[model samples]
Target chain A: MYGDQGFTIFDLQLWAEGLGITFGVFLSSSILGLIFGSIIGLIRYYNIIGIGRVLMLGSEFLKNSPVLVQLFLVYFGIPALFTIDLSPVEAAIITLSGNTAAFIAVIVISSIDAIDKKQLEAARSFALSEWQILRLIIYPQSLAFAMPMFVSLAINQLQVTSLVSVIGVVDLTRVGDIINQRTFEPFIVWPIIGVTYFVLAKLVERIGARLEQRFSVHQASSEI
Target chain B: MLDPAVMMEYMPAFWDGFIVTAEVSILSIIGSFIIGLLIALLRISENKVCRFAALFYVDIFRNIPFLVLIFFAYYGLPEVGIYIDAFWTGCFTLSIAVAAYVAETIRAGIQNIDKGIIEAAKSFGFKRVQIYTKIILPIAITSSIRPLGSVFINLILTTSILSAITLGELTSASKIIASTTFRPFEVYMFLVIFYGVLTFALSAVIAGWHKYLNRYNEA
Candidate 1:
């Protein structure tokens, strides 16, 4: 059993599949989180009645709690209580995306606040409507300010995706666990898994830096 | 639909787990604070090698997930003939992993120090050590109290990961209660709120402390 299991090409296929799942969950959840979180942030910015404060309270707990516990709640707790079928992958996506939204919401609010109010007033004086002012004046500057935080958040969330494995999502970490169990070589298996994540993080950082530079350029050119 | 009565029965076991979590958290906070402070200092040191080493330490730990690092320590240590229980391994891992965060915050704090103040201390005939102990570190550390508080709050939350190694921390203990009581939803939901409230209360206090420390400043 062990001889056939030792470093097979099939194992490499498994690793690739697991890495794909990890990246897939990460990218889709991040996109969803950004859209939902921005809406929440916009609600808060506009001071939407009752809804804003309730959303804020919910996100506060979401942000403060451990992601592992949150995963268990979504994966195990939700199905049992709600009597709904939630596969591991679905649960991972739901939980990670919601978690990401909570964080991105905070970043959105703060970055919007970081925009100078006089800029908003100046746009208003130029007879711009509220929606036009948001699109033309507010969006670009706040996005530039939020880029660095967004980058860090992306890197952190990528690592947080590892927890999905505990819920049985067969991510890279779970694949490592499977191979380690079969071969009983923790020393080799774990380092390989660790380096894979490290490289992914570095890649995210490089991409983020490029995005930041581009946004800053946009801000600079607009100011001129 | 959570029965508070059912949850209450597990309080004794949960309390024991809370004690373990508290011990690991306190030890790690102390450990990370010292290690982070040294690295923060090293990052600002004159020698290029020291600076590079510090940067390497922060980069590796900060990017790698704590779960991975913990798995590495928990599984890899005994393979090399270094046997230790999950408790110590957890404490050690948390300290090293969290120190990266603490060091970054402290580094930012140290860099924020006014150059004129350091120059003023030097001109006042204070030795280099005195300048650091008296003028530099105090201002840097004080200014960074809020950020460090958040870091420590995060460290407390990270303690939950120790459960994966079967260390019987809060998460592990609750896992038992959940299974035995057949109430995974209720048990974990309660645990989530427990941690959320704990961190929320902590950050509030840290904010007040930060404000108090900066009260004398005109800035």
Candidate 2:
């Protein structure tokens, strides 16, 4: 085996590119998951036809299984089963989004439940439509209640994004592995990589705190 | 193109892998629990240094991903002249990594104790040790059992990453089976379901235990 290759400026470029991919995948998957999960949560809340139970069961499996296993299933297993060409990034996004959605569903259901039934009943007395009640009452309160949890979950999901590297996605963790293999400097390489993630998470936490403060204003109900 | 019958031949091998996973999980659960308790105690200590150190430990561990930590322990330790095998490395890393979460959960439990209860304990002339051991800890831990159980369940899931370090755990064994059988899809899918069912059962038991312990506090 060749001794560890010395570090180069090119390696820094690779690191930046890898960071981009990691954040790109994390952002897209999170937004998509939130959309799908809110829909699932709303369906459950409204008790839609025959499918809510099935959806919940699906989310449970998604929630409970290890992300690495889910990644493998999507990247390797699905291609072998269906004879379809799948890029590592595509598989990573699909799997991570599904996983994120599962958690979002749980949060959505609980946050909605946190709102008062009396609020809905009161809205009904005012000749308000269901949609109007949802938009005017349930949305603001549930979002306020859900803010802290959403922030924590976002931070956790950023860490979870590292697992995508296992499926051959050239994310930050994979970049670290490549550099560590070449440089033979585990101590230097990994701490840098880990610190990158930590800082990103801290950034998310700060923004979330700001959002939480803004939402806390809505937490106080009007006397009208 | 799915065939379930192929798995029948690999059942014994899978069983062996399951045993390893179970062994490692049990050991780490115990290891982390002890560490978690100490750290949680440190977090609430009267001494400022102890509290700061404990918080720093928890912060670093919680922020970094488990895979990164596993790689660090598995590879970085060798450089520092500690030559443990993959199995021990996996166990040690999992314990230390998970202890962050366990400490936080336990700290929350401890903090959730009603200030009034501790004041009453002080009025009873129970000293600090008695207040902690006899009065506060039991109520805190029992009340927080459900959250603590989730931490354990997460610890079990984290064990699957040990396979990445080539520790012949359930995932690694299944990897071999999948390659040999030419059915990667079925093998991994089965593994997903198996882990899902395992965690679901563990959570159910934890819920039951929480209910039983909190029977007196139920509204």
Candidate 3:
């Protein structure tokens, strides 16, 4: 029972565009999160003045709360309070990046803790500088330890990207919502959207596994 | 500017919303725990098909976003003549969705049981069901309180997503007050702190419970 305004080639174009936006938002937020999360982790690691405690407290709030509320706070709340312009896409990126950074900061600290304390002591006795110890002793091992957690986090965050649609970003979920409203085909439309996300998550898992293996190999060879 | 007076005026509505959130979270916690326990059993069963089916359920639910799953339940169910309302829809989807996570946690707990204990139970003439209920599940469940607590805390946060379906939960209520008060900043900022404190207090209680349950192991 194909209606006159049923699925068309242009829907395909819209689908592709939605996929691109989803990937764009996910990738940009993830990279920014990783960078900022690392900085937060390092500050805590160094116990740099009062800033570390304040940053950690902020991160705890970020980690504990729902990302949806965070998105609304940034999108609707901040702009209204400041009387400034902030688009939905910008708000989505800002909120997701902060949320991702909260989780990543925890992962970084835990992974670094996973490394043996004696390794740091050995490096210190060998007259290694702080930078040298971090570079040569701590970094690689922690990366290996953190890889699995990172992969799982990536998968979780990819699924989280779906929430951006609530704030009016035309991501994959929003595309499904639009088509479903028009076609009245929830069964057909939502499944396609769900499968797209499923496939994307699987891809992330596959690449993460590969990266995990590579890091483990590097750790082993470098150990010798 | 933050306005305490504006927030005070909306306290009644926010309190009502918080009650709904608490109700849904409690119901879903019980629901997911039961479903997850069953799945964990099926996952570790001797039957190959049971294990495979359990694995498939976990994979599908875990990979798909909760919002997609909620939309499917909300919209698709009505079309199929199921006719469940939004509250039940949120609870149903959440129970099943969070069960995937609960199942994984319980399964991990189950697998870590010592093989000798199972054999000991068997040698003492315990039935398979008896062995599972009395020996395996007790140990696994007691040891997993901490992890299961985190899962439940996460489930509480996820109830906010139910707002999208017009369920009038805490976030939804906050949205209404924000628009009415024209103080989105103060409203959402308070909401954030509210949720953060809620989770922090929960995890603290859970940590105490976990420690109490596993106190024997510490010695």
TM-score of chain A of each: 0.95, 0.96, 0.95
Summarize candidate 2's per-residue lDDT along B1-219 as a digit string, tens digits: 999787889999999999999999999999998898899999999999999999999999998999888888877999999999989998899889889888998899889888999999899899999998997888878988899999988888888888888889888898899999989999999999999999999999999999999999953
Whichever of 1 and 2 has more DockQ, that candidate is 2
Estimate how well candidate 2 is docked, as a DockQ score. 0.81
Where model 1 places Cα greater than 4 Å from the true spot, the runs are: A1-5, A221-224, B2-5
By lDDT, the better pick of 1 and 3 is 3
* Candidate 3 C-alpha error for residue A56, in Å: 0.9
Ranking by lDDT: 3, 1, 2
lDDT value, candidate 1, whole model: 0.91
Itemize residue pairs with steric clashes in candidate 1. Answer: none
lDDT: worst 10-residue window of model 2 chain A: A215-224
Query: Would you give me the overall lDDT of model 3?
Result: 0.93
Give a tens-digit lDDT track for model 1, residues B1-219.
666566788899999999999999999999999999999999999999999999999999988888889988987899899999999999999999899999999999989888999998888899999998988889999999999999999999989888888999999999899889878898998999999999999999999999999999776
DockQ for every model comes to: 0.76, 0.81, 0.86
